[model samples]
Target chain A: MQFQPADVVARASFRLPAADSAEAAVRTCRPLQDELRPLAVEARAAGPDEPGEGFTVEFLLKLPAPQSDDVEGVLRTAAAPLLARLGLDAGKLDVDVEDRDAIVWAGDEALSKGGTACGAYVVHLRIGRDPDEPHELLPEGSLTDEEARALTETLNSLFEQRPVEEH
Target chain B: MSTPAWWDELMSVSDALAAADRAEVAYWRGGAEDGREDSHEDDVPPVTLRLAALGREFASHAHELTAEQQHRFLGVLEDVLRTGSEADGTAVATGFFESLLNAWNGGFDLQAAWAGVGAESQACCLDLNQFWGIESPEWMLPRVA
Candidate 1:
Protein backbone atom coordinates (compact mmCIF):
# COMPACT_ATOMS: atom_id res chain seq x y z
CA MET A 1 0.00 0.00 0.00
CA GLN A 2 1.24 3.50 -0.86
CA PHE A 3 0.53 6.59 1.21
CA GLN A 4 0.40 10.20 0.22
CA PRO A 5 2.35 12.38 2.65
CA ALA A 6 -0.90 13.23 4.37
CA ASP A 7 -2.37 9.75 4.31
CA VAL A 8 -0.21 8.13 6.98
CA VAL A 9 0.42 9.34 10.49
CA ALA A 10 2.72 7.55 12.96
CA ARG A 11 2.79 8.32 16.63
CA ALA A 12 5.11 6.85 19.21
CA SER A 13 4.48 7.53 22.87
CA PHE A 14 7.10 6.84 25.49
CA ARG A 15 5.60 6.71 28.97
CA LEU A 16 8.46 6.90 31.39
CA PRO A 17 8.39 5.24 34.78
CA ALA A 18 7.49 7.31 37.83
CA ALA A 19 11.10 7.33 38.94
CA ASP A 20 12.30 9.14 35.82
CA SER A 21 12.28 12.93 35.79
CA ALA A 22 10.72 14.82 32.86
CA GLU A 23 13.96 16.56 31.95
CA ALA A 24 15.71 13.22 31.74
CA ALA A 25 12.89 11.78 29.68
CA VAL A 26 12.98 14.68 27.22
CA ARG A 27 16.74 14.41 27.11
CA THR A 28 16.37 10.80 26.09
CA CYS A 29 13.69 11.52 23.51
CA ARG A 30 15.09 14.60 21.76
CA PRO A 31 17.75 12.67 19.90
CA LEU A 32 15.12 10.20 18.76
CA GLN A 33 13.15 13.01 17.18
CA ASP A 34 16.34 14.15 15.48
CA GLU A 35 16.99 10.65 14.23
CA LEU A 36 13.46 10.37 12.91
CA ARG A 37 13.50 13.79 11.24
CA PRO A 38 14.72 12.47 7.92
CA LEU A 39 12.05 9.80 7.74
CA ALA A 40 9.06 11.83 8.77
CA VAL A 41 7.51 14.86 7.15
CA GLU A 42 7.39 16.16 10.69
CA ALA A 43 8.83 14.59 13.82
CA ARG A 44 8.28 16.01 17.29
CA ALA A 45 8.58 15.09 20.97
CA ALA A 46 6.02 16.00 23.65
CA GLY A 47 7.00 15.94 27.25
CA PRO A 48 7.22 15.11 30.90
CA ASP A 49 4.39 17.21 32.22
CA GLU A 50 5.21 20.73 33.42
CA PRO A 51 3.47 20.46 36.78
CA GLY A 52 2.29 16.86 36.72
CA GLU A 53 4.27 13.73 37.63
CA GLY A 54 3.88 11.65 34.45
CA PHE A 55 6.49 11.85 31.73
CA THR A 56 5.51 11.04 28.16
CA VAL A 57 7.46 11.74 24.97
CA GLU A 58 5.61 11.46 21.72
CA PHE A 59 6.62 11.61 18.03
CA LEU A 60 4.08 12.60 15.46
CA LEU A 61 5.18 11.55 11.96
CA LYS A 62 3.70 12.00 8.54
CA LEU A 63 4.90 9.94 5.61
CA PRO A 64 3.87 9.29 2.05
CA ALA A 65 1.70 6.22 1.54
CA PRO A 66 1.58 3.19 -0.46
CA GLN A 67 3.52 2.98 2.75
CA SER A 68 5.07 -0.41 3.33
CA ASP A 69 2.64 -3.27 3.66
CA ASP A 70 4.73 -4.13 6.70
CA VAL A 71 3.36 -1.34 8.89
CA GLU A 72 4.48 -3.11 12.07
CA GLY A 73 7.99 -3.41 10.76
CA VAL A 74 8.02 0.27 9.92
CA LEU A 75 6.84 1.32 13.36
CA ARG A 76 9.21 -1.05 15.16
CA THR A 77 12.17 0.02 13.10
CA ALA A 78 11.54 3.60 14.08
CA ALA A 79 10.73 3.27 17.79
CA ALA A 80 12.64 0.20 19.01
CA PRO A 81 16.06 1.78 19.25
CA LEU A 82 14.70 4.87 20.98
CA LEU A 83 12.83 2.72 23.49
CA ALA A 84 15.92 0.66 24.21
CA ARG A 85 17.88 3.85 24.76
CA LEU A 86 15.42 5.00 27.37
CA GLY A 87 15.63 1.65 29.19
CA LEU A 88 11.89 1.88 29.60
CA ASP A 89 10.08 -1.08 31.05
CA ALA A 90 7.70 -3.34 29.22
CA GLY A 91 4.23 -1.89 28.53
CA LYS A 92 5.60 1.62 28.88
CA LEU A 93 5.81 2.50 25.20
CA ASP A 94 3.11 2.70 22.57
CA VAL A 95 3.14 3.18 18.80
CA ASP A 96 0.11 4.00 16.71
CA VAL A 97 -0.29 3.67 12.94
CA GLU A 98 -3.26 5.36 11.36
CA ASP A 99 -4.59 5.22 7.82
CA ARG A 100 -6.13 8.62 7.26
CA ASP A 101 -7.84 7.45 4.13
CA ALA A 102 -9.67 4.75 6.01
CA ILE A 103 -10.64 7.20 8.71
CA VAL A 104 -11.99 9.69 6.17
CA TRP A 105 -13.87 6.97 4.35
CA ALA A 106 -15.50 5.88 7.57
CA GLY A 107 -16.30 9.44 8.59
CA ASP A 108 -17.79 10.37 5.27
CA GLU A 109 -19.79 7.18 5.34
CA ALA A 110 -21.05 8.15 8.82
CA LEU A 111 -21.93 11.68 7.74
CA SER A 112 -23.74 10.37 4.70
CA LYS A 113 -25.98 8.43 7.09
CA GLY A 114 -27.15 11.58 8.98
CA GLY A 115 -24.56 11.73 11.76
CA THR A 116 -23.34 15.14 12.89
CA ALA A 117 -20.41 16.34 10.83
CA CYS A 118 -17.42 16.39 13.08
CA GLY A 119 -14.52 18.59 11.94
CA ALA A 120 -12.10 15.69 11.59
CA TYR A 121 -12.30 12.07 12.56
CA VAL A 122 -9.62 11.25 15.08
CA VAL A 123 -9.57 7.56 14.35
CA HIS A 124 -7.37 5.78 16.83
CA LEU A 125 -6.91 2.49 15.00
CA ARG A 126 -4.54 1.34 17.70
CA ILE A 127 -3.92 2.31 21.30
CA GLY A 128 -1.38 1.00 23.81
CA ARG A 129 -3.79 0.12 26.60
CA ASP A 130 -6.44 -1.68 24.60
CA PRO A 131 -4.32 -3.35 21.96
CA ASP A 132 -6.56 -6.34 21.58
CA GLU A 133 -9.66 -4.45 20.55
CA PRO A 134 -9.48 -4.36 16.77
CA HIS A 135 -10.28 -1.28 14.67
CA GLU A 136 -11.15 1.44 17.14
CA LEU A 137 -12.67 4.09 14.84
CA LEU A 138 -13.17 7.19 16.87
CA PRO A 139 -14.77 10.57 17.40
CA GLU A 140 -15.71 8.25 20.20
CA GLY A 141 -18.80 9.36 22.02
CA SER A 142 -22.08 8.01 20.74
CA LEU A 143 -22.93 6.97 17.23
CA THR A 144 -26.41 6.83 15.72
CA ASP A 145 -27.28 3.25 14.74
CA GLU A 146 -27.31 4.23 11.07
CA GLU A 147 -23.97 6.00 11.49
CA ALA A 148 -22.47 2.99 13.23
CA ARG A 149 -23.72 0.70 10.48
CA ALA A 150 -22.28 2.95 7.82
CA LEU A 151 -18.97 3.18 9.65
CA THR A 152 -18.78 -0.58 9.95
CA GLU A 153 -19.56 -1.02 6.29
CA THR A 154 -16.91 1.53 5.41
CA LEU A 155 -14.34 -0.32 7.54
CA ASN A 156 -15.26 -3.65 5.98
CA SER A 157 -14.94 -2.20 2.51
CA LEU A 158 -11.57 -0.75 3.35
CA PHE A 159 -10.41 -4.17 4.51
CA GLU A 160 -11.67 -5.73 1.31
CA GLN A 161 -9.82 -3.11 -0.72
CA ARG A 162 -6.40 -4.33 0.37
CA PRO A 163 -4.37 -5.97 -2.37
CA VAL A 164 -4.25 -9.74 -2.18
CA GLU A 165 -0.82 -11.26 -2.47
CA GLU A 166 0.12 -14.76 -3.53
CA HIS A 167 1.60 -16.88 -0.78
CA MET B 1 1.57 -11.96 49.67
CA SER B 2 -0.20 -13.79 46.92
CA THR B 3 1.46 -13.99 43.50
CA PRO B 4 -0.13 -12.15 40.60
CA ALA B 5 -1.83 -14.28 37.94
CA TRP B 6 0.58 -13.00 35.31
CA TRP B 7 3.58 -14.14 37.33
CA ASP B 8 2.03 -17.55 37.71
CA GLU B 9 1.56 -17.74 33.97
CA LEU B 10 5.19 -16.78 33.38
CA MET B 11 6.37 -19.51 35.73
CA SER B 12 4.27 -21.99 33.80
CA VAL B 13 5.92 -20.85 30.56
CA SER B 14 9.36 -21.20 32.08
CA ASP B 15 8.51 -24.71 33.22
CA ALA B 16 7.18 -25.60 29.80
CA LEU B 17 10.32 -24.34 28.10
CA ALA B 18 12.47 -26.37 30.46
CA ALA B 19 10.43 -29.49 29.80
CA ALA B 20 10.68 -28.99 26.04
CA ASP B 21 14.42 -28.58 26.34
CA ARG B 22 14.73 -31.87 28.20
CA ALA B 23 12.60 -33.69 25.67
CA GLU B 24 14.78 -32.40 22.86
CA VAL B 25 17.95 -33.43 24.69
CA ALA B 26 16.61 -36.91 25.30
CA TYR B 27 15.54 -37.30 21.72
CA TRP B 28 19.02 -36.43 20.50
CA ARG B 29 20.80 -38.55 23.08
CA GLY B 30 18.69 -41.59 22.26
CA GLY B 31 19.55 -41.21 18.61
CA ALA B 32 23.26 -40.93 19.37
CA GLU B 33 23.31 -44.04 21.58
CA ASP B 34 21.56 -46.05 18.90
CA GLY B 35 24.03 -44.79 16.25
CA ARG B 36 21.14 -43.57 14.12
CA GLU B 37 19.53 -40.36 13.08
CA ASP B 38 16.28 -40.09 14.98
CA SER B 39 13.18 -39.75 12.82
CA HIS B 40 11.84 -37.59 15.68
CA GLU B 41 8.36 -38.91 15.09
CA ASP B 42 7.66 -39.51 18.77
CA ASP B 43 9.57 -36.47 19.97
CA VAL B 44 7.79 -33.84 17.92
CA PRO B 45 4.34 -34.04 19.50
CA PRO B 46 5.26 -33.49 23.13
CA VAL B 47 7.78 -30.81 22.31
CA THR B 48 5.29 -29.07 20.10
CA LEU B 49 2.71 -29.16 22.86
CA ARG B 50 5.12 -27.68 25.36
CA LEU B 51 6.19 -24.93 22.98
CA ALA B 52 2.56 -24.16 22.28
CA ALA B 53 1.92 -23.89 26.01
CA LEU B 54 4.92 -21.64 26.37
CA GLY B 55 3.63 -19.47 23.55
CA ARG B 56 0.19 -19.27 25.11
CA GLU B 57 1.67 -18.36 28.46
CA PHE B 58 3.82 -15.66 26.90
CA ALA B 59 1.01 -14.19 24.88
CA SER B 60 -1.08 -13.81 28.00
CA HIS B 61 1.67 -12.53 30.28
CA ALA B 62 4.47 -11.05 28.22
CA HIS B 63 4.08 -7.68 29.90
CA GLU B 64 4.68 -9.33 33.26
CA LEU B 65 8.24 -10.52 32.49
CA THR B 66 10.83 -8.40 34.23
CA ALA B 67 13.61 -7.15 31.96
CA GLU B 68 15.95 -9.81 33.31
CA GLN B 69 13.30 -12.45 32.90
CA GLN B 70 12.63 -11.31 29.36
CA HIS B 71 16.31 -11.67 28.52
CA ARG B 72 16.39 -15.11 30.10
CA PHE B 73 13.33 -16.21 28.17
CA LEU B 74 14.84 -14.96 24.91
CA GLY B 75 18.06 -16.80 25.71
CA VAL B 76 16.16 -20.03 26.24
CA LEU B 77 14.26 -19.59 23.01
CA GLU B 78 17.54 -18.93 21.20
CA ASP B 79 18.92 -22.14 22.66
CA VAL B 80 15.94 -24.08 21.37
CA LEU B 81 16.28 -22.64 17.90
CA ARG B 82 20.02 -23.26 17.87
CA THR B 83 19.64 -26.82 19.02
CA GLY B 84 16.92 -27.51 16.48
CA SER B 85 19.15 -26.07 13.75
CA GLU B 86 22.11 -28.20 14.76
CA ALA B 87 20.18 -31.42 15.07
CA ASP B 88 17.67 -31.30 12.22
CA GLY B 89 18.60 -28.34 10.01
CA THR B 90 17.71 -24.70 9.39
CA ALA B 91 14.38 -25.53 7.75
CA VAL B 92 13.12 -27.49 10.72
CA ALA B 93 14.44 -24.98 13.21
CA THR B 94 12.97 -22.04 11.28
CA GLY B 95 9.61 -23.78 11.04
CA PHE B 96 9.57 -24.39 14.77
CA PHE B 97 10.59 -20.82 15.49
CA GLU B 98 7.94 -19.36 13.19
CA SER B 99 5.19 -21.47 14.73
CA LEU B 100 6.09 -20.37 18.23
CA LEU B 101 6.44 -16.77 17.11
CA ASN B 102 3.02 -16.81 15.49
CA ALA B 103 1.39 -18.31 18.55
CA TRP B 104 3.09 -15.82 20.84
CA ASN B 105 2.21 -12.86 18.65
CA GLY B 106 -1.37 -14.04 18.29
CA GLY B 107 -1.83 -14.35 22.03
CA PHE B 108 -1.16 -10.68 22.72
CA ASP B 109 -3.32 -7.60 22.42
CA LEU B 110 -3.35 -6.42 18.81
CA GLN B 111 -1.60 -3.15 19.63
CA ALA B 112 1.11 -4.98 21.54
CA ALA B 113 1.66 -7.29 18.61
CA TRP B 114 1.78 -4.33 16.26
CA ALA B 115 4.08 -2.45 18.61
CA GLY B 116 6.08 -5.69 18.75
CA VAL B 117 7.89 -7.33 21.70
CA GLY B 118 9.26 -3.94 22.83
CA ALA B 119 12.51 -2.45 21.60
CA GLU B 120 14.78 -3.93 24.24
CA SER B 121 13.75 -7.54 23.63
CA GLN B 122 13.31 -7.29 19.86
CA ALA B 123 16.92 -7.82 18.81
CA CYS B 124 17.21 -10.81 21.13
CA CYS B 125 14.01 -12.46 19.95
CA LEU B 126 13.82 -11.56 16.25
CA ASP B 127 15.56 -9.01 14.09
CA LEU B 128 12.75 -7.33 12.15
CA ASN B 129 15.02 -6.41 9.25
CA GLN B 130 16.40 -9.93 8.84
CA PHE B 131 12.99 -11.43 9.50
CA TRP B 132 11.39 -9.22 6.88
CA GLY B 133 14.46 -9.14 4.61
CA ILE B 134 14.55 -5.36 4.67
CA GLU B 135 17.71 -3.37 5.14
CA SER B 136 17.98 -1.52 8.43
CA PRO B 137 17.31 2.23 8.67
CA GLU B 138 17.06 2.29 4.90
CA TRP B 139 13.62 0.71 5.09
CA MET B 140 12.53 3.68 7.17
CA LEU B 141 13.44 6.01 4.33
CA PRO B 142 10.36 7.47 2.72
CA ARG B 143 9.79 6.57 -0.92
CA VAL B 144 9.72 9.53 -3.28
CA ALA B 145 7.68 7.76 -5.90
Candidate 2:
Protein backbone atom coordinates (compact mmCIF):
# COMPACT_ATOMS: atom_id res chain seq x y z
CA MET A 1 0.00 0.00 0.00
CA GLN A 2 1.10 3.54 -0.64
CA PHE A 3 0.50 6.64 1.43
CA GLN A 4 -0.92 9.79 -0.03
CA PRO A 5 0.97 13.05 -0.06
CA ALA A 6 -1.10 14.11 2.92
CA ASP A 7 -0.09 11.10 4.97
CA VAL A 8 3.58 11.96 4.55
CA VAL A 9 3.10 15.39 6.07
CA ALA A 10 3.56 16.28 9.73
CA ARG A 11 3.68 19.50 11.70
CA ALA A 12 6.06 20.40 14.52
CA SER A 13 5.21 23.25 16.87
CA PHE A 14 6.80 24.72 19.99
CA ARG A 15 7.54 27.96 21.78
CA LEU A 16 10.94 29.57 22.14
CA PRO A 17 12.07 30.81 25.53
CA ALA A 18 10.22 33.82 26.93
CA ALA A 19 13.38 35.86 26.76
CA ASP A 20 13.74 35.72 22.98
CA SER A 21 12.24 38.27 20.63
CA ALA A 22 9.67 37.52 17.94
CA GLU A 23 12.15 38.48 15.23
CA ALA A 24 14.70 36.04 16.57
CA ALA A 25 12.12 33.26 16.61
CA VAL A 26 11.23 33.89 12.98
CA ARG A 27 14.85 34.18 11.96
CA THR A 28 15.71 30.99 13.79
CA CYS A 29 13.05 29.04 11.92
CA ARG A 30 13.87 30.61 8.54
CA PRO A 31 16.32 27.89 7.54
CA LEU A 32 13.60 25.23 7.63
CA GLN A 33 11.24 27.11 5.35
CA ASP A 34 10.96 25.88 1.77
CA GLU A 35 8.76 27.44 -0.87
CA LEU A 36 8.99 24.55 -3.33
CA ARG A 37 7.92 21.94 -0.81
CA PRO A 38 5.09 21.49 1.68
CA LEU A 39 7.30 22.96 4.37
CA ALA A 40 5.78 25.93 6.20
CA VAL A 41 7.28 28.06 8.95
CA GLU A 42 5.50 30.63 11.06
CA ALA A 43 6.29 32.66 14.15
CA ARG A 44 4.03 34.95 16.13
CA ALA A 45 4.01 36.92 19.35
CA ALA A 46 2.45 35.05 22.26
CA GLY A 47 -0.20 36.15 24.71
CA PRO A 48 1.06 35.36 28.16
CA ASP A 49 -1.21 35.92 31.10
CA GLU A 50 1.53 37.97 32.66
CA PRO A 51 4.17 39.03 30.15
CA GLY A 52 7.26 37.85 28.29
CA GLU A 53 6.04 34.68 26.59
CA GLY A 54 7.91 35.99 23.53
CA PHE A 55 6.79 33.87 20.60
CA THR A 56 5.72 30.49 19.19
CA VAL A 57 6.76 28.83 15.93
CA GLU A 58 5.33 26.02 13.82
CA PHE A 59 6.65 24.09 10.85
CA LEU A 60 4.78 21.79 8.53
CA LEU A 61 7.31 19.57 6.83
CA LYS A 62 6.39 17.11 4.13
CA LEU A 63 8.34 13.86 4.41
CA PRO A 64 9.12 11.48 1.58
CA ALA A 65 6.84 8.68 2.66
CA PRO A 66 5.67 7.33 -0.68
CA GLN A 67 5.03 3.93 0.86
CA SER A 68 2.71 3.56 3.82
CA ASP A 69 5.38 2.01 6.01
CA ASP A 70 7.94 4.69 5.29
CA VAL A 71 6.20 7.04 7.70
CA GLU A 72 8.28 6.20 10.77
CA GLY A 73 11.61 6.28 8.97
CA VAL A 74 10.86 9.68 7.49
CA LEU A 75 9.74 10.99 10.86
CA ARG A 76 13.06 9.99 12.41
CA THR A 77 15.03 11.68 9.64
CA ALA A 78 12.96 14.82 9.99
CA ALA A 79 13.47 14.92 13.76
CA ALA A 80 17.26 14.99 13.66
CA PRO A 81 17.62 18.11 11.54
CA LEU A 82 14.75 19.78 13.36
CA LEU A 83 16.20 19.13 16.81
CA ALA A 84 19.63 20.22 15.67
CA ARG A 85 18.11 23.52 14.59
CA LEU A 86 15.38 23.98 17.18
CA GLY A 87 17.55 22.33 19.82
CA LEU A 88 16.23 20.22 22.69
CA ASP A 89 15.81 23.17 24.99
CA ALA A 90 13.37 24.97 22.69
CA GLY A 91 10.22 23.60 24.33
CA LYS A 92 7.72 20.77 24.08
CA LEU A 93 7.53 19.66 20.45
CA ASP A 94 4.17 18.37 19.26
CA VAL A 95 4.28 16.51 15.97
CA ASP A 96 1.11 15.20 14.36
CA VAL A 97 0.57 13.42 11.09
CA GLU A 98 -1.73 15.44 8.88
CA ASP A 99 -3.55 12.24 7.99
CA ARG A 100 -6.82 11.90 9.84
CA ASP A 101 -6.44 8.21 10.70
CA ALA A 102 -3.01 8.32 12.29
CA ILE A 103 -2.59 7.49 16.00
CA VAL A 104 -2.25 10.57 18.23
CA TRP A 105 -0.80 11.70 21.53
CA ALA A 106 -3.55 12.36 24.05
CA GLY A 107 -0.93 13.10 26.71
CA ASP A 108 -0.88 9.40 27.62
CA GLU A 109 2.38 7.48 27.32
CA ALA A 110 0.89 4.01 27.86
CA LEU A 111 -2.27 2.24 26.84
CA SER A 112 -5.26 1.59 29.09
CA LYS A 113 -3.58 -1.55 30.49
CA GLY A 114 -5.19 -4.36 28.48
CA GLY A 115 -3.17 -5.10 25.37
CA THR A 116 -2.78 -2.06 23.06
CA ALA A 117 -4.66 0.22 20.73
CA CYS A 118 -3.76 3.35 18.82
CA GLY A 119 -5.45 6.56 17.87
CA ALA A 120 -4.20 9.42 15.68
CA TYR A 121 -0.49 10.16 15.10
CA VAL A 122 0.25 12.99 17.47
CA VAL A 123 3.27 13.04 19.77
CA HIS A 124 4.27 15.57 22.41
CA LEU A 125 8.04 15.57 22.92
CA ARG A 126 8.16 16.75 26.52
CA ILE A 127 10.90 19.35 26.41
CA GLY A 128 9.42 21.92 28.74
CA ARG A 129 5.66 21.52 28.69
CA ASP A 130 5.59 21.07 32.46
CA PRO A 131 6.15 24.66 33.50
CA ASP A 132 3.16 26.56 34.83
CA GLU A 133 4.34 29.60 32.92
CA PRO A 134 6.16 30.20 29.64
CA HIS A 135 8.89 31.96 31.61
CA GLU A 136 10.01 28.66 33.08
CA LEU A 137 10.96 26.26 30.28
CA LEU A 138 12.23 22.70 30.80
CA PRO A 139 13.68 23.86 34.13
CA GLU A 140 17.38 23.15 34.48
CA GLY A 141 18.89 19.78 33.53
CA SER A 142 15.40 18.41 33.05
CA LEU A 143 15.60 16.59 29.70
CA THR A 144 18.14 14.04 28.58
CA ASP A 145 19.04 12.88 25.08
CA GLU A 146 18.13 9.28 25.97
CA GLU A 147 14.64 10.29 27.11
CA ALA A 148 14.00 12.24 23.90
CA ARG A 149 15.07 9.22 21.86
CA ALA A 150 12.73 7.00 23.89
CA LEU A 151 9.82 9.37 23.40
CA THR A 152 10.55 9.48 19.69
CA GLU A 153 10.34 5.70 19.68
CA THR A 154 6.97 5.79 21.39
CA LEU A 155 5.70 8.28 18.80
CA ASN A 156 7.02 6.17 15.93
CA SER A 157 4.99 3.11 16.81
CA LEU A 158 1.74 3.70 14.95
CA PHE A 159 0.03 0.49 16.05
CA GLU A 160 1.34 -0.06 19.56
CA GLN A 161 3.95 1.21 22.03
CA ARG A 162 5.67 -2.16 22.01
CA PRO A 163 8.58 -0.68 20.11
CA VAL A 164 9.40 1.60 17.20
CA GLU A 165 8.11 -0.44 14.28
CA GLU A 166 11.18 -1.68 12.42
CA HIS A 167 10.34 -0.36 9.02
CA MET B 1 -28.41 35.53 37.76
CA SER B 2 -28.77 34.76 34.10
CA THR B 3 -25.64 34.13 32.05
CA PRO B 4 -25.15 35.90 28.76
CA ALA B 5 -25.77 34.11 25.49
CA TRP B 6 -22.08 34.16 24.58
CA TRP B 7 -21.30 32.64 27.95
CA ASP B 8 -23.61 29.76 27.11
CA GLU B 9 -21.93 29.36 23.73
CA LEU B 10 -18.48 29.40 25.26
CA MET B 11 -19.68 26.94 27.88
CA SER B 12 -21.01 24.64 25.21
CA VAL B 13 -17.78 24.90 23.28
CA SER B 14 -15.60 24.13 26.28
CA ASP B 15 -18.01 21.48 27.56
CA ALA B 16 -18.14 19.68 24.23
CA LEU B 17 -14.37 19.81 23.94
CA ALA B 18 -14.07 18.47 27.48
CA ALA B 19 -16.62 15.80 26.72
CA ALA B 20 -14.59 14.73 23.71
CA ASP B 21 -11.45 14.36 25.83
CA ARG B 22 -13.47 12.62 28.54
CA ALA B 23 -14.86 10.25 25.94
CA GLU B 24 -11.35 9.52 24.72
CA VAL B 25 -10.29 8.77 28.28
CA ALA B 26 -13.30 6.46 28.57
CA TYR B 27 -12.56 4.73 25.27
CA TRP B 28 -9.00 4.04 26.36
CA ARG B 29 -10.18 2.86 29.75
CA GLY B 30 -13.22 0.96 28.50
CA GLY B 31 -11.54 -0.75 25.59
CA ALA B 32 -8.57 -1.91 27.63
CA GLU B 33 -10.28 -3.01 30.83
CA ASP B 34 -12.96 -5.34 29.46
CA GLY B 35 -11.65 -5.79 25.92
CA ARG B 36 -14.65 -3.96 24.56
CA GLU B 37 -14.36 -2.63 21.04
CA ASP B 38 -14.56 0.96 19.97
CA SER B 39 -18.00 2.24 19.18
CA HIS B 40 -18.71 2.37 15.48
CA GLU B 41 -21.44 4.92 16.06
CA ASP B 42 -19.30 7.86 17.10
CA ASP B 43 -17.43 8.36 13.84
CA VAL B 44 -16.26 11.80 14.76
CA PRO B 45 -13.02 13.31 13.48
CA PRO B 46 -9.89 13.68 15.58
CA VAL B 47 -10.17 15.85 18.67
CA THR B 48 -7.75 18.42 17.27
CA LEU B 49 -9.78 18.75 14.11
CA ARG B 50 -12.91 19.23 16.11
CA LEU B 51 -11.06 21.55 18.46
CA ALA B 52 -9.71 23.57 15.54
CA ALA B 53 -13.10 24.04 14.00
CA LEU B 54 -14.60 25.06 17.33
CA GLY B 55 -11.72 27.36 18.12
CA ARG B 56 -11.98 29.03 14.74
CA GLU B 57 -15.64 29.49 15.36
CA PHE B 58 -14.85 31.09 18.71
CA ALA B 59 -12.24 33.35 17.18
CA SER B 60 -14.58 34.60 14.52
CA HIS B 61 -17.14 35.45 17.13
CA ALA B 62 -14.62 36.61 19.72
CA HIS B 63 -14.41 40.15 18.41
CA GLU B 64 -18.12 40.58 19.00
CA LEU B 65 -17.86 39.56 22.64
CA THR B 66 -18.56 42.14 25.35
CA ALA B 67 -16.85 42.78 28.64
CA GLU B 68 -19.46 40.70 30.43
CA GLN B 69 -18.54 37.77 28.28
CA GLN B 70 -14.89 38.27 29.05
CA HIS B 71 -15.61 38.53 32.76
CA ARG B 72 -17.61 35.32 32.74
CA PHE B 73 -14.96 33.52 30.77
CA LEU B 74 -12.20 34.74 33.07
CA GLY B 75 -14.26 34.24 36.21
CA VAL B 76 -15.15 30.62 35.55
CA LEU B 77 -11.59 29.66 34.66
CA GLU B 78 -10.27 31.62 37.60
CA ASP B 79 -12.70 29.99 39.99
CA VAL B 80 -11.55 26.61 38.83
CA LEU B 81 -7.85 27.37 39.00
CA ARG B 82 -8.02 29.49 42.13
CA THR B 83 -10.62 28.25 44.60
CA GLY B 84 -12.12 25.39 42.54
CA SER B 85 -15.32 23.57 43.25
CA GLU B 86 -14.71 20.95 45.90
CA ALA B 87 -16.62 17.88 46.93
CA ASP B 88 -15.75 16.46 50.34
CA GLY B 89 -12.59 18.57 50.32
CA THR B 90 -11.50 16.99 47.03
CA ALA B 91 -11.09 19.28 44.05
CA VAL B 92 -12.69 18.42 40.75
CA ALA B 93 -10.94 17.94 37.44
CA THR B 94 -10.27 21.40 36.03
CA GLY B 95 -8.14 20.43 33.11
CA PHE B 96 -10.52 21.73 30.44
CA PHE B 97 -9.33 25.35 30.52
CA GLU B 98 -5.77 24.35 31.26
CA SER B 99 -5.79 22.05 28.26
CA LEU B 100 -7.40 24.78 26.20
CA LEU B 101 -4.73 27.28 27.21
CA ASN B 102 -2.13 24.68 26.39
CA ALA B 103 -3.60 24.53 22.92
CA TRP B 104 -2.69 28.18 22.66
CA ASN B 105 0.77 27.86 24.28
CA GLY B 106 1.60 24.19 24.62
CA GLY B 107 2.03 21.45 22.04
CA PHE B 108 -1.23 21.57 20.06
CA ASP B 109 -0.15 24.42 17.76
CA LEU B 110 -3.54 26.07 17.63
CA GLN B 111 -2.28 29.24 15.98
CA ALA B 112 -0.85 27.09 13.23
CA ALA B 113 -4.26 25.54 12.79
CA TRP B 114 -5.61 29.02 12.21
CA ALA B 115 -3.15 29.70 9.45
CA GLY B 116 -4.81 31.56 6.56
CA VAL B 117 -8.09 31.51 8.46
CA GLY B 118 -7.81 35.33 8.53
CA ALA B 119 -6.01 38.04 10.40
CA GLU B 120 -9.00 39.06 12.50
CA SER B 121 -9.60 35.57 13.83
CA GLN B 122 -5.93 35.15 14.56
CA ALA B 123 -5.98 38.49 16.31
CA CYS B 124 -8.93 37.33 18.37
CA CYS B 125 -7.04 34.22 19.45
CA LEU B 126 -4.12 36.38 20.50
CA ASP B 127 -6.50 38.60 22.37
CA LEU B 128 -7.90 35.60 24.18
CA ASN B 129 -4.36 34.45 24.92
CA GLN B 130 -3.46 37.82 26.36
CA PHE B 131 -6.74 37.95 28.22
CA TRP B 132 -6.15 34.60 29.80
CA GLY B 133 -2.57 35.53 30.60
CA ILE B 134 -3.34 38.84 32.22
CA GLU B 135 -6.32 37.50 34.09
CA SER B 136 -4.47 34.46 35.31
CA PRO B 137 -0.71 34.78 35.22
CA GLU B 138 -0.61 31.09 36.05
CA TRP B 139 -2.67 30.17 32.99
CA MET B 140 -0.31 28.30 30.71
CA LEU B 141 0.09 25.01 32.61
CA PRO B 142 -2.54 22.75 34.02
CA ARG B 143 -3.22 23.32 37.68
CA VAL B 144 -3.09 20.58 40.30
CA ALA B 145 -5.42 20.56 43.27
Candidate with the greatest DockQ versus the true structure: 2
Query: Model 2 over residues A1-167: C-alpha lDDT tens digits?
Result: 12243344444544454324333453444433422122334344444431225455444444443333454444444444444443332133334333222222223332121111211122222111211112332334556888778767876885564756787
lDDT of 2 by residue, B1-145 (tens): 1112233344643444345434543442345423346533233222222233434333444445454554454444344334432210011111222234444554444433333323333333344456446443333223377
TM-score attained by model 2: 0.26
**Displacement of the residue A164 alpha carbon in candidate 1, Å:** 59
CAPRI tier of model 1 = incorrect
Stretches > 4 Å off in candidate 2: A1-7, A18-24, A32-38, A45-52, A66-74, A77-167, B1-145
Number of the top-ranking candidate, with lDDT as the measure: 1
TM-score of model 1's chain A = 0.30
After TM-score superposition, the amount by which residue A151's alpha carbon in candidate 1 deviates from its true location, in angstroms, is: 79
lDDT of 2 at A158: 55
Report the Cα interface RMSD of each model, rounded to 1 decimal: 21.0, 16.6
Q: Estimate, for each residue in B52-71, the C-alpha lDDT of model 1 and write its tens digit.
A: 34554555565665556655
Candidate 1 chain A lDDT trough over 10 residues, lowest sum: A38-47
